[model samples]
Target: MVFPRPRPPERSDPASCGTHRACRSCWRDPGALPQGHGRIRRYAAGADLAAQGEPPADILTLIEGWLLLSALLSDGRRQILHIVVPGDVVVPLLVGSAGFGIQAATDATVCAMPVAAATTSPTAHPAGLHVLMKAMSRNAAMAYEHLTAVGRRTARERVALLLVELYYRCRRAAIPDHAVQIPLTQGVLADALGLTAVHVNRTLKTLRADGLVAYEGGMLRILDPDRLAAAACFDVEAAGAWLGPCPPGPPTPVPPTAPMPPGASR
Candidate 1:
């Protein structure tokens, strides 16, 4: 079921949209876009938002919950391309072809806008173009970084880095370290990191033993913030160096309340 949800953003002057930083700034800038049409829709956990090879016909911004961009192999194996959280834009593919499909990892709500607006905004609005460029560069850098991790990183390093990535993605200035939660299972981790489920289990066990992180059921708690990345030789600083400095951004803002679609579970 889909419902109309367009609650105006109460983003008090300084706030974090908490998705992709570049896009956050784009939304805040009044001149960033011209008036556009958009509507909100909701999906249940495990629902297919976009089918494989399907080109996105609209600009979809995740309003709540989690989404996974993944590809299914001939042998029935799946590799997760990336995870989508609130304030993040969802694109099946950024270039060439979209061999992937998007699924709601949890019950999710999305705001979809006209793709034509996105295609024209950059040219009609210079600020929009700048944001688009920044987003592209960030995407490229992350793609390279992910490729490097799968090719060169150890099992522990890969798992650790993946968790750290999620931690930062969902980071909230008000949420304490222990309170930060990522609702993902080991199978999801294994798919995202290119590892066997058994290997992912052992690696997580070792991480728990080291007192760096904890995983039980489908939830994860980061026990030690300072040591989690360092424990796996995952250098967040070095990775950022390639992309240039990121000025301190405001804390991520809570998303607008979107009413659930009828028949959706709580």
Candidate 2:
């Protein structure tokens, strides 16, 4: 199912909107933009940014909110291939090849430009571009890790690994690691982990029992990150150095309560 690219950002007074370091790092080069660059747009809680099998267009960077990239099987089952957060970019082709990529989840705000323009922008510094490439590679590696999690880890271990991964990513984005925040649902987690929703539920309970994590109403708290990472066979340091010094940014803030994603209880 192909969906249209999101609308271009509206022209607005630059003076009215406050600037953040993270978004600046993404679109500007030390406080300046290349000529001909477009504006950054905002997306509501359930907007669709891209669809499967569409033409390769601009490179999209999620400045805010959570996004899921998914692929569907012939049987009509959807497999969430990736989860994107602020500062993450999605292109049809990560490095080599071409095809339409689809958005698998929701609550995403995206900024995109023609791929050619994006690559040539001076503000799109070489280092920033390199970081984006590395981000894509990391996402690929994560997919492999997910495969292993479902294929080898016990149900409990899978849940632990998922929570650990989420916490780690939230930390990198500067989101509060202990905050009660979970943007995905048990069913979505099941799809990504290749488990049934019921099994995902049971495994989550097991994680709480082991003091590894806690989940309620789609919110999760990592009780023992070390133990959880160990159970998932996750080495925090293995996350490569491609992120480029975590980009100058303010800590990610928890917004006032909003509607959780579909299938999410809390």
User: What's the TM-score of each model vs. the native?
Assistant: 0.74, 0.74
- lDDT against the true structure, each candidate: 0.61, 0.59
- At residue 186, give the lDDT of candidate 2: 70
Candidate 2 lDDT, 1-266, residue by residue in tens: 43355443333223211154445656445333333454455655545555566556666667667777776655678777777767676766735433334452555556655566546655555755665566567667777888887789888777777776766565566544334355677777887777788888777666667876554454566667678778877776664443223223346533212123344332
The reply for model 1, stretches above 4 Å from the true place, is: 1-26, 92-96, 121-124, 172-178, 215-219, 241-266
User: Residue 64: error of model 1 in Å?
Assistant: 1.1
Candidate 2 runs further than 4 Å off: 1-21, 27-35, 94-101, 104-106, 120-128, 175-180, 215-218, 240-266
User: 143-224 in candidate 1: lDDT tens per residue?
Assistant: 6877888999999988878776665665532133223446676688789899987888778778778887544433455676
